[model samples]
Target: MTEKKLKVDLSVPFPTEREAQIACGTLSVDSEPKRGGVKKELVVKGNVLNIHFEALEARMMRVGMNSFFDHLNLVIETMEKFGPPEK
Candidate 1:
């Protein structure tokens, strides 16, 4: 079997840097402007094309693994409420 990478495209309608930042609450960490998909790997400035990688194991957390899962669920819930803002 091979490793497959999944890409998610966000359909936000913001066309300006300030609009993007205010709408999503993420500051631009880049010096130059950009548009479109980011690299497959993680980028310092998580944006429109950010990819989140999940590890199979949870080894470094103050709480137990179950607590981590619950925390993740809360994150998802927040995302759902925010409708996946570019960050």
Candidate 2:
């Protein structure tokens, strides 16, 4: 039997395009691990960062999303603490 594909979409808005770009760059560096059965994609448009996730199972999707949120929180915190990088 063919496995079903589950998906999730997330959008995060930053204060500026630069900040959004920075977050996308930082977060995109770590692709989802192969064993997790999840795939992730990141993109930045204007001041918004978009994330797309696909997984074979709901559990896998939940785990992947939790991990992503952890990293995203760090990125936002870092931006809030230190601001965006220099142009």
lDDT of 1 by residue, 10-68 (tens): 23333344333443333222211123222212222322323232322233221232343
Could you give me the TM-score of model 1 versus the true structure?
A: 0.28
lDDT of 1 at 79: 56
Backbone clashes in candidate 1 total 0
Task: Tell me the lDDT of model 2 at 73.
Answer: 98
Could you tell me the TM-score of candidate 2? 0.93
Model 1 residue 53 distance off true place after TM-score fit, in angstroms: 14
lDDT of each: 0.35, 0.92
Candidate 2, residue 17: lDDT: 92
Please report how far candidate 2 places residue 75 from its true position, in Å. Answer: 0.5
Estimate TM-scores for all models.
0.28, 0.93
Stretches > 4 Å off in candidate 1: 1-63
